[model samples]
Target: MYRVLIVDDEPMILKGLTVFLQQSGVSIASIRSASNGEGALAAIREELPDFVFTDIRMPVMDGLALCAQIAEMDQKVQTVVISGYDDFTYAQTCISYGVKEYLLKPISKPDLQDTLRKLIQRAEAAKPASAYLSVAKMDEWMAEIEQAIYYMNQEQVTQLLHTWEQEIATYHMQDEQRIEMLQEFHVLLMKKLKARDVNIELRPLLELKQGMSFHTVYQQFTGSIQDTLDSLYRRRKGKLKDPIEEVKIYIEQNLGSEVSLEEAADLLGLHPNYFSVMFKQMTGETFVQYRTKRRMEYAKRMLGEERYRITDISYAVGYADHSNFTKTFKKYEGISPSEYRQKMGI
Candidate 1:
C-alpha cells in the first residue's frame, strides 16, 4: 500500500480522480487532494506521498514546475502528469523532470493500473533486503561468540564465525543483506565486549569503500573479529598471575583491620564481581572464609602467649569485640576460646 497525492485545479476532477483511484483495484494508504502545485508541494512535504498525479495546466504553479520541484526534493517519488494538452512539448518537459507517466485528461483504467503496478515494483526494489530479515534470530551466534571470547578461545571463535557464514550462505541471503548482517553483528560484539571491559577499543568491520565485493567486506569483518579476540586474549594472559597469593599476603599484613571484597578488588584494579568470581575459582573459598580461617589460626597461636589477653588477641585478629570473636571462634573450632586454651594447656 502507498500514499498518493492528486493535484488538479478543478474541484470535480480532483473528486473524480480520488473516487476512481479508490475503485481502481489499487490499494493505497491515502488519496490526498491539492488544488494547485503550491498546495501539492505543501502536502508532499507533510508526508512525502509515494505517487503524485498533477495536471499540466493548473494555476498558482503548473504541473511541469510541480514535477520539477518534486524531483528535486526526492527523485524516488513517482510522478504521473495528467495533461489537458496532448502537445509533444509538454510531454518532453515532463520527461525532463523524470516524470515517466504522462496521461491525457480523459484517463483510461488500463493506463492507471499499469502506472500503479510500475510504482509498486519500483518501491519494492528500493527497499533493502535486510528489511525482510529477522536479526534477532542471530542471538545464538552472539551468545556463542561471547562465551568463546570470555574463555579466550581464538580457535573456537574462528570456527564459530565460519559456521555463521555457512548458515548465512545456506539461507542464500543477498549481498546487501549480508552486508547489513555484518554491521549488526559488529554492534552485538561491541556491546558484549564493553560489558566485560569498558576501555576496550573497537572499530567497525570495514571502511566499506566503493566497489568492494561482498566477499571482501565479509573477509575483512571476520578478520577484524579474530584480531579483536587475539588482542583481548593477550591483555588477559598478561594478568594471568595468581592474584590469590597477593590477597593472602595482604590479609596476613592487615588481619587486624576491616576490609571488604570491593576494596580489595579495587586495590588490585579489578571489578568486584569479576575479582570475586576469579578469587573463588582459584582458591576454592570465598574471601571471608579464607580470611576467617587465617585469623583463627593466628588466634590459636596467640593463645600460647599468656601475656596477651584473649580480648587483646581478638582485636589483633580483626575482631574489635571479644564476644563476636568468641562466637566466630566457636563456630570454626567447635569450642570457645577458653576451652581451646584449656585443651592445649595454655
Candidate 2:
C-alpha cells in the first residue's frame, strides 16, 4: 500500500483528486490533501508520501519549487503535475525536476489510473535488489569504515569509498538509492565519532546540496572526517596531560575493571575533589557518567559481533552481577544487552 498527497489551491480539485485516487483501485494506504505547497511540504516532512499530485500555480511556494524540494528530500517519490496552463516552460521545468507525469486540469479518470498504474509498476521494479548486502554484512562494512577512520588510514578509507562507488555503479542504482546509501554512511561515521567521544562541528558536512555529484559529495565528506580526526590527534599530541583525553583512554582500556573517580584522579596526580571538578569542566560529564557511557559503547560493539553470551559480556564490561549489568545496560541503552544484540541481528 502507498500513501499519496494531493496539493492544489482549488479546494474542489484537491477534494476530487483525493476521492478519485482513494477509489482508483491503486492500493492506496492513505490519501492526504493540501491547499498549498507550504502545507504540502510540512506534511511531507512529517511523513513522506510515496506519491504527490500537485498543481503548478499556488499563492506560496509554487509547484515547481515544491517538486524541486521533494526531489532533494527523496528522489523516489513519484510526482505528477496537474496544471491548468499548458505552457512549454512549465512542462520543461517539471521535466527537469523529474516529474513522471503531467496532466491538464480536468484530468480524466482513466488517464489518472493509467499514470498511477505505471508508477506503481515502476516503484515495484525499483525495490532494492536481491543481491544487496544483508543487514549484518552492512553493519560489518560500516564497522570497517569506522576503524579506518579511527586509525587515520586515508588510503584504506579512499579505497573503500572507491569500492563502494564501483558497487553502486555496478548495480546501476538510481540517484535516490545512491543518496540514501551515502546518507546512511554519513550517519554511521558520525555515530562512530560520537561513540569515541570526539566533539566536532558537523554543520557543513550535514548540509547536502541538491544535485551535487556523488564523487564531489564523497570527497568533501571524507575530507571532513579526516580533518576532524587530524585536529583531535594534534590536540592530543600537544596536550599529553589533558585530563579528559586521559580519562577517555583509561576508561576504554579498563572497561572490564572497576574504574573509580579516585583511582583516575590519582593516576593524574591531583586531589580527588580537584580532579572531579576538572573532569566535569573538561568533558562536561562526571567521571562515573563518562566511564559508564564508554562501557556501554564497548558493550554495544561487542554485542554487534554475536559471539559472546550475555553473562560473559556482562563480566567483560566490569559488572560482577549479571542482574546489575542488565540493569545498567538497560538504563544506558533503553534495552537489555540481549535485546540490543537481537536488534543488531547478531
Candidate 3:
C-alpha cells in the first residue's frame, strides 16, 4: 500500500482527485490534500508521502517551488504535475525538479492509474537495504556518533557517518525497532548539539520508515547533521576565529576597563543581538558573568600581594569604588576580601 498527497487550490479538484485515485484500482494506504505548496511541503517534512499529485500555480507557493524545495530538502517522492496550462516550459521545469509525471488538469482516470502503476512498480523494484549487524553493533555506532558530535569532532563524525552510510543497508530489524532506531538517531543528534550549546533547528529526517529506502534515510540523517556541523565549522573558521574567542581576547587585554558588548560586536562586524546569542552559545556564559569572574580573579591575585592595598587592588581590576568591589567579590567568593586575605595569611 502506498500513501499519496493531492495538492490543489480548488476544493472540488482536491475532492475529485481523491475520488479518482480511490477508483483507480490502485492499492493506496492513505490519501491527503493541501491547498498550496507551503502546506504540502510542511506535510511532507512532518511525514513523507510516497507520491505527490500537485496542481501548478497555487497561491502561497507554486508547484514549481514545491518541487524545487522538495529536491533541496533531500526527500524522494514521486510527483505528478497536474496543471491546466499544458505549457511545455512548465512541464519541462517541473521535470527538472524530478516530477515523475505530468497530467492535464481534468486528470484522465487511465492516466492517473498508469502513473500509479509505474510509481508502485518502480518503488517495489528498488529493493531497500537491510542491516544485518547485531543490535549491539548498531547501539555502538550510534554511541560513537553521539560522542563525536558532542565534542564537535568533525573528522571523527565524518568517518563515522561514512561507515554508517554503508552499514545502514544491512539492517534486518523488525519494523517497530527499525523506526525506533531512526528516531533514536534523531534524538541523539539533538542531545549532542545541545551539549555543545549550539542551537540547531532540525526536522527529524527519518519520519516514515515504510516507504523510504534505508539508504535514503541514512543519507538524509547524516547529511543534515553534517550540514549543521559544517556550518558551525565555517563560523569557527570565519574571518579570524569565532567571534566569542576574539571578544575573550579583547576582554583579557582590557581587564581594567569596561567591556562593551556593542564595542565587541562592532569589532566583529555583528549585530549586538547576534553577538550576544553567539557568545552565550559558544562560552556557555553571559558577558557580564564572565567579565565579573575575570575581574575577581585578577583582584584576588592582587590581594595576595603585600605590596597592593585592597582598595588599590580593586581599582587595578577596573572597580573604582572599593565598597562596590567588596560587595561584588563577596557575592562571587562567598566571603569578604579582608576575610579572604586573612584566610590566605597575606
lDDT of 3 at 197: 42
Instruction: Give the candidate order by descending lDDT.
Output: 1, 2, 3
As for candidate 1, its clashing pairs are: none
Clashing residue pairs, backbone N/CA/C < 3 A, model 2: none
Highest TM-score scorer: 1
1-346, model 2: which lDDT tens digit per residue? 5789999999889887886775453445689888788999999888888889999999888899999999888557899999999898999999998897999989867688778867776776677765343333344566677667655566887787677667666655566666666666576566545544334323246567788777677777767766765765785564334456877888888999998998887776556755786688678889899888888888888888867888888899999899999999999999998889778877
Q: Residue-wise lDDT of candidate 1 within 1-346, one digit each (tens)?
A: 5699999998988887886676444445689999999999999889989899999888899988998898888557999999778899998988989888888978765577677767766776787754443333354567678667656677788898788777677555678767866776676577656654554545577567765667787788777777776676687774533456878888899889887788778666666766776688778899889889999999999988888899999999999888999999999999999999899887
lDDT of 2 at 227: 76
| RMSD value for candidate 2 | 19.1
Error of 3 at 148 (Å): 61
Q: Among all windows of ten consecutive residues in candidate 3, which has the lowest summed lDDT? A: 129-138
Residue 33, candidate 1: Cα error in Å is 41
Candidate 3 accuracy as lDDT: 0.75
Q: For model 3, which pairs clash?
A: 130-169, 130-170, 130-171, 131-170, 131-171, 131-172, 132-170
Residues 72-170 of candidate 3 have per-residue lDDT tens digits of 866658888899997999978987998878989787666776777677766665545353334335546756876565346888998988887566545
The per-candidate count of clashes, in order, stands at: 0, 0, 7
TM-score of each: 0.46, 0.37, 0.38
